[model samples]
Target: VAARSPEPVTPSLSFPQRREKIERRQQEVENELKMWDPHNDPNAQGDAFKTLFVARVNYDTTESKLRREFEVYGPIKRIYMVYSKRSGKPRGYAFIEYEHERDMHSAYKHADGKKIDGRRVLVDVERGRTVKGWRPRRLGGGLGGTRRGGADVNIRHSGRDDTSRYDER
Candidate 1:
């Protein structure tokens, strides 16, 4: 058999460029780590708390008061009443951090449907903010035109009567 020449290997990138790429990768990993629940890991054994978001809260409710109310159900580590960055006032919602999974469950159980100043609050895990990728197209004619004046917009989801609202039987 004839001997074949070896293929040439590509040169390694420069140290500075390689290090920069590594740093960027590390930062991405750190951001992803922030999204994970520590309690979800079976190997994780610590006093760290799980965070929950409560929406539809009274705008006047303070963080301390929110925490105190949830403390009756479980050990609350902290409460952050979300506020509008522009207005510098409460945004009618809050995020709660509890010290244990049991506390998180208890808070969700008892806190939901509980009225706070006549407004029932809804609580759940604090999911990452979803980016609005698209806006829905407006129906009917432009601002000045009436809805009926525009082209017909038929919704055939159920295949029912097309115009029954106006049936004068």
Candidate 2:
């Protein structure tokens, strides 16, 4: 048996190199998103059932890190880290696709609130695109939001079988 060495982390690179790498990864992800029309792509249908939506991820976390963290449940197919187009930086969320729907559900059950890269991430069954009439956090809809001294109208999971909610009310 042999142990595998961890992949090179950002610390191994000089500051300038790290910045460039991050920018490049962000650009790549954003460009892929721009070209991906999964809703209409027949190839993406399986992803809807076998994907876990992970939120509140650490901004610096990488895809390999996420795979190592989540693969305990089962084999992973892919990881899609979301990024902001204008900022060209991580958006603190990602979609983890598993090779099997059962694996996806297992991750949804066990990975929520699990610490990753020093941050506790939220995990849920992917819904925004699969569920009808569901909206993301940007369009005034999301699973959860913190109170900012306004009307207590915060909603998350919205009675839709979410268990990892960090509700502060």
Candidate 3:
């Protein structure tokens, strides 16, 4: 007697059914995009107007120029221009601290998306420290270790053998 092989299972949807499924998925994505708001993030809820992160700043932008521009809104507590460690040049970004929250909010509303020195600048409330989480990575290329504080592991050898080739002296 000959044995019969089982046929592979395939999706039984018709052409019309497949097209309807794709159209439904596309509509869901469009709805999600329409409902999304960048400024309504939960992390930016409390005391987010105290500090502002400015990006795409002109390289020739000076501290005095930044101060003069922002001073029109309110008093500034401090301005820190990020610099490259190797080149010792401005990194085209900075952190602006306001003495009052109202000033910070005013600066954020006015300066964001504004052009300075012909470069459009991006201004937003500074984000807090990122939450630590387990990030999975591919094994190999000298990256085969577990996360910290979990447990001690030896990846070089298996634990099946009890004896070593060398004697303990």
Candidate 4:
């Protein structure tokens, strides 16, 4: 006599349950896209226009190299590669200037989350003031031209001696 194997029974998942699972997966993807997508970002282009200061760059990277690499995505106005002040070595970061807001939109869209020299590059607008050749004015003659908090005293120099005339007067 041939013995029939018992049929395996499985509980069926509900439609809403399956839909919820799909929705959760979709939400995760949406979140990831939102985090990295520069095009959809409202802050990408504003009154300031999109600009980015890149950091953690390779020591050998040059401005022209970075510009050429990034120009494939969009038109670059300027690229300033940061160098160490003391050591004069590349700081592994650069500032990228875009001509148009749309250019930035495209550059950032493709630049973010992208690896350069085995490291990821960050893109953001430049909001800081770039001051160059800053020189502070010399404040000579302390506080309104008075010496040691005393009233303005005039010193008169005579040919022979001013001290003798002062004592006699």
Best by lDDT: 2
lDDT of the structure predicted as candidate 2? 0.74
lDDT of each: 0.59, 0.74, 0.64, 0.56
| Per-model TM against the reference | 0.47, 0.60, 0.48, 0.44
Candidate 4 runs further than 4 Å off: 1-50, 129-169
- Model 3 clashing residue pairs (backbone): none
lDDT, residue 37, candidate 4: 36
Q: Pick the candidate with the highest TM-score.
A: 2
Task: Please tell me which model should have the higher lDDT, number 2 or number 3.
Answer: 2
| Model 2 ranges with Cα > 4 A deviation | 1-38, 41-46, 144-159, 162-169
List the lowest-lDDT window of 10 residues for candidate 4.
134-143
At residue 74, what lDDT does model 4 achieve?
76
lDDT of 4 by residue, 1-169 (tens): 9999889988787999999998887787666544543344543343335466565566776677788778887777767776678998887777787777677656755676566767777664343321122111121111222223323463322111234221232
Q: Total clashing residue pairs per candidate? A: 0, 1, 0, 1
* Model 4 clashing residue pairs (backbone): 57-92
For candidate 3, write residues 85-153 as lDDT tens digits. 899999898878888877776776688878888898877556431111211122111223421223356
Question: How does candidate 4 score on lDDT?
Answer: 0.56
Error of 1 at 57 (Å): 0.6
lDDT of 1 by residue, 1-169 (tens): 9999999999998999899998887786666555544337543333323666688898877777787778887787777676788999888987777888667766765687678777888775443321112111221111122122323543322111233221212
